[model samples]
Structure formats: C-alpha cells, structure tokens
Target: MMIGTLASAMASFARPGVCKAAAAYHGPPASNFNLGRILRYPNLIGCNRSPTKKSSAQLQLWRALTTLTKREGTVNGPAGTRFSTVADGVIAHNDHAASRIAASVARRQLTCTMGRVNYDVVVVGLGAFGSSVLYHLAKAGLKVLGVERYGPVGHSLGSSHGASRIIRMAYFEGLQYGPLLKRSMRLFLELQDELAAVQGPLSEPLFLRTGMLDVGSVFERALCSAQVQGLQHEVLTGAELNRRFPAYRVPEHWRALYQPDGGVLTPERIVQAHVGLAQRMGAQVLTGTTVAAWRVEGTGADAAVTFKLVPTDATAVAASKRMSYSDATATAVPRNVTAAAAVLTPGPWIGQLVPELRELCVPERQVVGWFEIEAAARSHFAPNRFPVFVLEETSGGAAYYGFPEHGQLPGFKIGLYRHLYEQIRNPGDLDRVNRTANAADEAALRSGVLSYFPTAAGRLLTSSTCFFTNTPDGHFLVERHPRYPQVILCSACSGHGFKMSSGIGQLISRMVREGPKDTAAAAATNTLQPPPPLPPSAPSPSAVDRHVVQGLPQMDSDSDGVDWSELLPFRFSPGDRPGHREALDRFS
Candidate 1:
C-alpha cells in the first residue's frame, strides 16, 4: 500500500514543467524534502487515509527517500523503502515493516536537530586563507563559522605562523596574477587601518613598506611582467645592488629587479586581526576543535551540511576553554555548528580528510630561521634601509629569501624557498622544533648568509619547523570538489600563498556567494545558483578562468614555467620545485 501511493505521487510530481528545476540538478541528491511540499503534493497519501495522519506522513517520507536515492544512483532496497545510503557502498536492506517505521522516526529526529544549528557557509582551517574567507563572507552578511585545529594563535603549527611573509606586485609566478596582486596590495593596506580602529593602535604595524629585489633568471620574467603591468621597478646589475644596499655581495654577472612597493605582512597579527573583525561582523570562530566528518542533507536553499566534532588534546582544549565569543547581536554561541556550504582550507592536514587529494596535496616539512645581526649593522637591516630580497644563486643554484628585522624580532629572518624540505607522511605528527637547525641545514644557509649579507650571520637566534601543503605542480588548488559541489577545496598553498591570501579570500567569498561560474551565470545575472558538473579528478582548464579571471594571457611561449593556457594551479618551475634546484644555478 505504501509503495503504490509513493508511485502515484512520483508520477504526479514528475510532470514536464512541474519539476523542471529539480530535474536540472546534476549534483548529488539529498535524501531530504520540504515537509510542507511533501504534504501539499496531490495524492501523496490515498484519499482512504487522512492527509494529517502519522502513518500517511511516514509512508510519503519513506517513498521520497527512495526516490532521492535512485536519483543519486544509489541502490534500491526491498519494498522500495530505504532511509539513505552509507559511505561503504553497501545497500542497507530494510526487512521488517516495523524497522522501516523506526528508520523514518530517526530521520525526522535528525532533521529537527540539524535545523537548529545553521549557517550559510562554514570555513574549516583558520589560517591565512580561511580567516580571510571568514571575514569577507561575514562582512557580506552571510552567516559564517570558522574552525581551526589549534587553540591559540600563538601555537604556530601551520604555514601562516611566521613573523612575516613578503608581498609584492611584480609576480614572477605569472602575469595573470598581476591584477590580483594589485588588488591584494590595496586590501592589505586597508586591513592595516581597519585592524587599528577596532584593536587600538598596534605597537607593531601589520605591513611594512620595505622595497623588494629579485636576483637570478627569475628576474627576467619578473621584470617583463613588471613592464607589461606598468609597475614602478628598476633593473639593476649585480654591482648596483651591492653598491646601493652595501649589506650584500652580489656576483657581477647576475642581474636584479627592484620594486619599491613590496613589503612584509606579519602572519600572526594578520590571523588575529581577521578573526577579531570577522567575529565582530557576526561570524562564529571555534578553535582547538577538529571537524571529524560532514555530510550533505538537502538540496539548494533548503540544503544543509552537518559536521561532527572530535575532542582535541588537553592542552589545546584547556587553552581555548575560556576563549568564548559573543555573536554580532551579543548572543552566546555553542561550539558545534551546521551550514549550507563548507570551505575546507585545512592546509597540510587537508589530505587526512579529503582522501582524493592525498597524493596531490603532499605535506613537506620546512624550516625558517632568524639570525641575529651585529648591533652596529642592525640599522641597515631595517625596512627603510634594506629591501626584502630573493636571490637565485648562479653558483649553487639555490634560491633564498629574507625579511628585514621588524618589531620585537631581534634578528633578520631567512629561509630557502624549498631547499631543505623533508616530506611529512602525516601532518598530525609534525615536529614543531624540526631538529633545531641540524648541521646540514645550518651549513647550507650559512654559505648563503656569508655570501650575501656577511654582517648579519651573527648567530642562530631562533628557528621553527612548518609544513608546506604542496600540490603536484606547485600551484594553488582553489575550487569546489568534483564529487561534492557543496564542499570547497582551498588547500595546497605550496609555500608561496600567504602573500596573495587577502586577494584569494576575496575570490573565495564570491565563489561561495555566486557558486561556480561556468554552469551558473551568477555573476552576470546577480543571482546565486548551483554550478554545473565538474571534470573527473579535477576541474577543466576553463574552470579557473570562469572564476579566477575572465581570460588569462599566456606566459612565455617556451619558458620553463607552466603553460598559462592550461592555468595549472599551484604551479612552480622544476628549479622552483620545493627542495629541488639545478646544481649549476646559484641564486635561484
């Protein structure tokens, strides 16, 4: 009797024009329905039984769940009644009639419980990109929640915990990023002023305008991009760099590109500022908690994503135990949450949760160290006196970068972009101390230090180990998952993403608001809609174009860099590959 009634109801709702929108949905289907809509559908229950009867509602809901399962390519059960499909590909059969009734009751209870905790978007990972997304989404009036693994900002486990990261407009990565870089610089400056207003005058500013210089083969591409973008930059020979800076001994055969607009952005303060501002704008941020699992529950506006939380370590929980935040309207918030959409920017740990990208988003251990400079020469390492520099050595073929001494840090900070990277099998078991700068690590950096700024190699003041979530090609992975359209993948920074994270956050905000661009013309029509089908394993080349930019110009036709037409994300050159460089190339 229940199967017969459900068959009639499906036919009635399947009419050509009646469910055209529902038929257009290509993504996975949720085994859920709007209760009011189910009640209103004609003949949902035979005229023999009252429409409001509990038995009739249960049968109707059971039929709806079976229909959704079929649409989602799930296996059907005996008597055509099943609650939902499990992850292990097993068709949980319903045998007894009483068992079906119990399943319906449990599902109803779950729906009610899930409806209480709701948000438009939930961001996992509160590092550089995640925090920025939280701020932008909340500012746009979307109910947002941010989750981080560590308790306090000072824990410093991930990639965004360093004293400072360099930000420059003349990008050697690609000319296509030139516009976004320009926009990021503007936003970075604006963020500094915004943070000061709410948090009071910071003893140390967020961004310091220290000019930047790039020396090596990378300089040609960077200079060319600078010229094309009409940016302010000067091309100098090795002698000029050495003569002007005085702290460096440059090989006369090499060249350099100098841009004055470049500077350093403090990572710790940036994360804190973004979180504080986002919370004030009505976003809820939970730290020291892990998102164990999540599942999609419905479709479209009625769609809901529920996440399960796992208890963290004693240290992290204790640290965050007293750290509570009031909502924008001053209401206290609980620790758990649910949302319509979720953004996963978990950094190196993303692989553990997203099994598909495990091979692609490999976590590699990296070390960053600070070295004290002679007191008499400390003034030269200041932002105004010395510019941030990237050197590609022609001798040893290694590229190293450093930031001038700033604020409370007692020494200049430097590190090989990817020279000493050690692959980490699991991010959870990361060694924070990273072996305390062993002899090999110290010796490699010592050579570069003595060769470049001989006066600053006083002593190793401090060092810390961090993980770089590297993609196969060393480009960023910023798009919605192919299997789960509701889940956004924003990991694989590849060690160079923090500089443009502000811009990346803005781009992600639009993606969450407008959906994917190819299938849904949300940007052109100003309407938020679901995106179309994604390609297998990854998005098509045009996917980045549709969302990241309208049309990207090609990079050098025959250069060692990736083909711009392909728009491969998280792209780095063979020499630029983390910890791998040509033996002959010195200052890369």
Candidate 2:
C-alpha cells in the first residue's frame, strides 16, 4: 500500500501542465496521495515489525520522490525511476542502473535531500575550481547550484581571472602529484575533444602544448618526478639550451630540464567552458550573487544548509538600464537558499567564511607584468620557438616564471613567484586599481631580462594584480569543516593552484557524491608532501657551486593505488584548537 501511494503520487505529478497552469498550486491534492492513505495501510507500512522505523523511512522516501519529481517536471516509472532534464534543471537519476543511490535511500542513509532541502550541493565561488566542481557534479546527475560573488568572468583580483596560467608535468615539488597531474592532463585533453564535438574543430584552442623549461636546481626534483611517473623529459646543459633557443643567454653553469608536455592553460576560457557545460548538464549558475552567510542546521543525515545571499554588484543593472528602477530594487532583495551539502570554494575569501582557518591560509596580493618584445625577437619567443620557463637565482631569491607569447597578450607575460606581495586584510576590498606596474616592478623584471633574455627586454606594457591564498606548508586545504561535515572547504591554492584546478575540481565533485571515499582519494594524492633535504655530497642540479635549486609546490597529479586512510582529514579534538592538531595527527 505504501508503494501504491507512492505510485499514485507519481501518477499525479505526470499530469501534463496541470501544476504549471494553476496560478497557485500549493501541492498535490488529497485525492492524489495523502497522509490518511499511509495511516490506513498499517501492515504495508511495516507496523507488523518496527512501525515507527518503516513509516518514517517510507514517508521520507515519498517526500523525497515528490520533491525531486516536482523539480524534474516528470514522474518516471515506478521502481525504475529515470530522472532526466534539459539544461539548467535537476540531475538525471536512473535508479535501476545506479543501485547505490536506491540502496542508500532504502537504508535511510541518504542525507543529501531530506525535508525542505532543495539542491544536493551548492558551490560557492564559481571560479575555475568551483565551475569545474559544479560541472562534474551536474554531469553525475546531482542537483547542483553554483553561486559566484562576481560576474561570469570572475573578479580580476582572484587567481582564476587571467587568460593564461602555466600547465606542466615535470613537477619539481614532489612525486606525489605525479598521478593527479597526469589525470588532469588527460581530463584537459578530453575537455578539448568534448569542446571540439560541440563547437566544431575550428573553435579556439582550450589548451596549447607549447612545451616548458625549468632553469634551476629544482629541475632535479622534476627529473625524479618524471622518472618515477614515466613522464617524458629532456636534460639540457646551458650550452645546449642556448643552442636550442637563441632568445636567452644561458649561463655556462646553469642547467635546465625541458618537458615537451608542458603548455599554457586558458583560465578564463576554462572557467567559462566548465560553467557552460555545467549549465547544459542542468546545473544552475548564479553569478554576481554574494553568499552573505551560510550555516548548517541539524546533523549528519538530518543536516541541511541555509545560506543568505545578496547581490555582489547592484549598480551594474541600474547603470545598464536593462530594467526599470522598480525591477532594480527587486534585484537587490536578499534571498535565502537551502541545500543538502555546500562547498565553499571562495578562494581568497575562504578565510573570511571559515575564521578558524584564517591563520592557516592568508590571501596575498601578487602581480603579473606583461613586457613588450621587439619585432626582431618576437619570432624567437613564439609558441613553437620557445617554451614556458621558471627561472631562479643562484643565491635562492624569489623565482620568476613566464609563458611564450599566447594570442591574448601583446607582450610576454612574466611575474615573480611568491614575491612582490601585500597582505590582503579584506578579501572584498582588493586593491585592483592602484596595482599598475610601478618603477620597482619594472626595474626588477628588467634586471632579470638583462641577465637572461637580453634581446627581448622591452618596456613594461601592462600589469594585473591577483591574490594568492597561501597555506603555511603550501599544501592545499581540501577537507571537511571541523564542525560541519556537511560544509566542505576547498580552497587556499597558494600561488600554484590554477594548473591543477581541473583535477582538483574532479576530486571535489567526487567528494560531494561519494562522501568520505572521494575526499580520501583526493587528499591522499593532492595533499602536499615536500621532498626531504638533499645531502651536501649530492650532485647539484645546475652542476655549479654558485647555483642552488629550491623545491616548492608547483604541479598536481594522482596515483593509481592509494591508502585511503593516508588521505583522511586531520583529526581534531572537539575543542577550540587552530587545526585540530590532536585529531589531525591521525592522518599524519
């Protein structure tokens, strides 16, 4: 009888245009499926066994199905329900094919959508990482919503707003990222193919394989990583480097590691692609909407997310005159959104949302300067002629990185890694205006040019400032909130996260769907593990006594076999400690 009532509710929802036509259709009528029907069928509701348990489970299931059907606009066949929808709707679910979902619901362990919870996951911050997470989640048939604090292009202050970010496989950081990096590369290639299918072959390239070069002792680690991960690379002495690319004067002592696989990533395009794919897959993306506050109500299976939202920019609509003043006023009205699970990928603004992590990850203002290249040397720095490079000083000062000429910029884009930073006290008020290239910035970059690429050193053309949300250990913080397991924290990429955004996004999506298991896999592969210090007798990477190569978090990868426990979130005592050090030791 309980199943019969469920079938009746399904039938009632299948009535075409009945609910849409009604000016105010509150819910299904009593004739459809009412509480009285369930009360009458005592035995069917398991009153013969644990009455309360069976009744509660059935009611919850019934309510969940009704809510889902209402959102999906169709009630599928009885037991083998097939949930399907077009762009910007709900996730498609085929219960028969995916038994895990049905079994979860039957076991009463499905906390994703309980009473009143609308979406399975609400992603805050629709930048590169957030957009990717939303796309993957929506593609997996989960009701997902993406909320961004800025416009569709994202705020210029964040790291994901640029036209280009470097992608490399020869990681100098450590070997742990090997597997994840390879996975990301594959996904990126797949994304390109997917885009080609939809937008035609002539569509602008998403990823350009221009190759990459590492000009520092850190290349030793890269060589090690390449060897361990079966990645292809070439070792070049300074003489060989100068012979291959005439753009720069390689010092006799400086050796370099070259990887043909490294290339440039179009960040803005990637974000847009993710957002586009996600929307097409029925994920709702809300741009220019700031998440004012979010809190979890209840706990575990009964938990729900309640968030207050406000417009990130109000004057834009009024200035554009797209709507009347009355409509503009309505746009500013605050909205309350509820979800089963919420992912906070706010990037630099993460600390503001979770105060406990404020100390762990701090946002720093970093600059990228574009310098003009002479017509004579332009051909030398073209995508085919020269590869992207990360050059370091012999005395262990700040490292500098730059890319070959991509179409977006009129000049060669270059910037110092982790240097030239100002602490961002407030994530909202990032100094976007006054961050133009000053004399010091120009002089510093020119000095490097004079020392290395002498011919291409031209005037500073343009510059932009972005934030680097850095952690102390430089590892990513992709774990659950200490207090709220329903709330996941997925940000603080330091200065080297954009390249890994694709893989990180996939891992994050998996976490939302599979819970602990996905999170463990991601954490195991992605969490930072710095290489052990080398002995003095070890041969220097540069083969010169004056030069030194320091390792840092640069690339991302994942391995096949993983010890799930090794990737568990840091344990913490139920106290007011910073990182829950006592409990975090469990993973350590």
Candidate 3:
C-alpha cells in the first residue's frame, strides 16, 4: 500500500533528475517495510529510506522514486523500520545504485560511480565480451579490471547461467559471425586448457562439428554459409530426418538444413572459465559490483569518461565497495575515443538496461525444464547422438531446441524460446517468477517429443523455468554505444551467443586494445597477413539496424573483424530462388 503513497510523492517532482534531501517526515499507515525519501532540488529524485546501510535494491527503488517524488517522507513497510532517507548527511551523496536504476528505468540518461579510485581500463561487464577482452588485454600486459555485480561467472540473472550452450561454425545469422564462431570453438579449447577444470563444469567437453538445423523463413539465403564457405552440410527429406533420428517425428511440411559442425555450449561453466582465465591473467574479475554512472568528457584522458561502481561484495571474490575509471584523466588530452563500449550482457536484464532492444530482446520465460527419459533415450538428444535441433512447422505449430545432459541438469532440457513474456524496467525488480511454460507449452513440446521419440516424452519428471535474450533476426548487436562515442556495445544474443563467447571475447578485447590506434600501414608494413578461409554456412545475424547501430565487440584479438556470419546454419530467401520450394520441402 505504501508503494501507492510513494508513487504520489514521486509524481510531484518536476524533472526526474533534480534530487534533494527532505526533512524526516512520516506518512499514514506506517510499517517497517515502508521508508520515507528526501529529494534534492534540480535533480527531482529522492534518497533510499533504509535506516541501515542502504541495500542495492533499496537504492534502486529510491532512484525510481526520485524520478517521481521530491517530498521527503518515510512510509513504513510491513517490517516497520524507520522509513528514513539515506542522503541524511552531507558526505553521504546519492550513490551509484540510484544512477544506474534511474538510467535503466528511464532508459534515457543518468550518472554512475564505482570506487574511491578510478581505473585506466575498466571492463564494465564480465560476460562473453568483457571477460575475454580483459583476459587478452591483461595477458598482453595491460592493467585491466573486470567487474560483475552478480559474482563469479553469472548469478542466474541473464543468458550466462544456462547448463548447456550450442556451438557451431556454420552461421546463418550473418557473414560477420562466421569467423567469430569458428574462432570461438578453437579459443574455447584454449580456454579449457587455461582453466584446467577437466570434467568440472568449466572443463566439460561439448559435442562439436555435428550439424544443426535452421528451420525458419531465412533457411534459403542462410544456406549461403554452406554453399560459399563449403561447410559440410546437406538438405534432408522429412522422411530421411525421421529415419536418421528416430526421436524426431518430422512433420510433413517441415524442412531440415544441416551443418555438420553445429554443437552445444554450456553456460555457467564457460563463464566460469572466461572469468577464471581473466583473473589468472591478472584482470580483477569482481562479481556483485555494478557500474552506477558514466560521464563523457570533452578533454583529458581520464576525463573523457568516468564510471562509478557499487561494491556488492557478497558476489565479489572479496567484498569491497566501489571502483572508478576515467578516460579523460587530464584536461590536456582531448577525447580521442569516439564512444565508450558497454558490453550489456545482462542476459535477462536486457529488458531493463536498454529498452530500445526490448522489442528485439523479447524476454521469454523459458523453463530449462527437462524430462526423466531413460539414459539410453538420451542418445536422441545427445550432442553426438543428435545435432542440436531447431524445429519449426512441427505437428503442434511450435518451435524448440534440445541439448544433451551435461551430468547435472537432467534429461534433455528442451523448450520453445517463445513461451512467456514479463516486462521489467528495474534490475531490482528481477526477483520474482518470470514467465514459465504452462501445461499447454509442456503439452505441445511433449507431443512434439513423442512424435519424434514416442517414449521419451512419457518419461517426464520435474521441470523449471529460466529466461533467454532474443532479437528479431536472432543475430547479435555489436556496435558503438549509439549516444556516447567512448562506449562500445555488445548484446542481444537472441539465444545463441554462448558458444561463440570465446571468439567474441577475443574480438572485443582487440577492439579495446586497438581503440582507434590501428593504422592500416601498420598491418601492410608488418606483413601480418592472413589465415586460410574457414568453413561457413548460413547468415548469422544480419539484422543491420544498419543505422550505425552498435553490435558485438567488433574485432578479434588480432584486430581482424571476426567474420561472424559464416557461422550461421542457413540464410533466408533473398528476394526469390528456385531451390526455395525444394528447400522448404526438404525439412518438411
């Protein structure tokens, strides 16, 4: 009920940014849970009401409240703690938590802070791009720091915590992703060596070079990957597909395009590896630390940009609070970088952090739920036994993918990536049940499973839900942070970015290292030329917002733009083609 009163107070503010301190005031229906806020002028925002050291969520809520309220007063919650404000003192300023929450909630502009001392090169995120870049840069002898508020690896918040991720060289997403995927698998092997966790989550091996299917509208042109790149693959008849894998009862109209190199990617373990490697290489990988704000400077090295971080030590390797990094460190150095890159791999947090990607980053409440099929039945879905599959036009008008059991998460977990949708605007608001597969969703999948492996679906047992970050064309966005030049961005996995993280990390790292320093003459004069052409398949993520929109960290450690598109399994019909019908009928 206090949330209602809190809303009214916030509504009174003129501009959300103007914040100030309000005298301690109490409201009706007081309780421990409700806290009063104090708003500062010009910046129409209020401070956290926590009487204790402000918790992160409280700080975020306070920032949201700031956008709406200016009158400082405490409203008691169920617990009955004094709904007092946090900016109760001159030294205690509005924290980074407030700024990030405001930025994410408003999705327009905000500020942030991280530590007492700012850093030279700060990796704002630790997912696929950030961690990889940190590791490579550190190894290259760069002083680097990698901070992640969610802790080592990921804390089950985004696209990084899933059990298994699919990996393949044949890309249908776009030509840009092909080289990236191929390089990813190789670096994954290298990363495995670095972590030395053989058999553990990070060390677990995945099925590779096993073909995958592209079952959507883009299958035709997507196949350019297979044709031009010569990646081993073929078009199979629905009957042949059924015979090849007795588990799938391919629908008459469904089509199957296979690329022999496709396989699975494990989420948690891989992140562990990337983080571990980055840390070992001397990059400080901090979990539970979040960037609160960023400043763009017109002059100086460290002054060009500044990021504030909040120490959520609970998740960090060591509990410490705050870290700061600035590019325009001195007023003499004019801003050299055009934009700073924010590798926004918040997984599910994509909905909140960047609302523009909201439509494309549809947050599907997918259950990583699995069946209790017999171990023998696992062969049907196993990476070696089965090429990771994508089913469209199935008997039930649905689509989904299946992965082999990696020892833990149980019998082949498979669900459509298009199940539930829960819109989130605040990162602090993420602690509830997201969308999950309902009985109908399970039933549809069960029917499809039964049609493929009649007995497998019947062996079902427990099931649960998780989430995925999606995009319209299922490709990734790797570009400069649109508004700020010093910021580069990498996000919108759309469900298939895990396997490529290794390669992606290297590319992002190279971009950071290159940081506008690459001269073409340096390459030609140095004779640092070429590798043989790699295998290819479909177009991987050609969703060119084409408007100079940002994309995955744009280069490999070698500074070469990793050609990622060649890795996609298939491309769509570009305008028209004769093989279209034949192609459509093959998987059907």
Backbone N/Cα/C clashes per model: 20, 11, 146
Instruction: Tell me the tens digit of each residue's lDDT in model 2 across 1-588.
Output: 333434333333322222222212221221222221222222232223333554454455446555544543332223322221111121112222223333333333222232355566889987778878887776655667888776644445467855688888778865666555655666676676677777785667778887889886666777776565455568898889998988768786788888877888887778777777666555777766777788888866667788898886664322221211111111232488777778999888886677666666788877777778888889888889888888876536758888777675787778887756667766555523245667776777777777778776788887776678877556667777767777788887778778777777776776665554355445456544534545434533320111111231222211122223222332232353344463354323
Give lDDT tens digits, candidate 1, residues 1-588: 434444333333221122222222221111211222222232332323333542443455446645544543222233332121111010111223223333433333222112233566889988889988888776554557787777664347678876788887677776666655655665666678787776675445778888889888779877866666666678899899888887777887789999877788888778777777877665777766687777776764345667887645756445332222322332323545676678999898886667666666788877777887988888888888889988887544688888888877778788887756687766466523353578777777777888888898989888766778887556787767665677777888888888778777866775675443322433234322212323233422321112232122232211112122222233223355442233113212
**Residue 385 local lDDT, model 2:** 83
In model 2, what is the error at residue 516, expressed in angstroms? 4.8
The TM-score of candidate 3 is 0.60
Clashes, model 2:
11
Q: Which is better, 1 or 2, measured by TM-score?
A: 2
lDDT of every predicted structure (CA atoms):
0.62, 0.61, 0.48
Off by over 4 Å in 3: 1-117, 197-203, 206-210, 215-222, 252-254, 297-304, 311-344, 350-362, 374-383, 394-397, 421-428, 435-441, 459-464, 471-473, 516-588
Whole-model lDDT, model 3? 0.48
Top TM-score hit? 2
Task: Give lDDT: candidate 2, residue 461.
Answer: 80
RMSD of each: 14.4, 11.1, 19.3
For residues 77-106, write the lDDT of model 3, one tens digit per residue: 232222111211111123333332222223
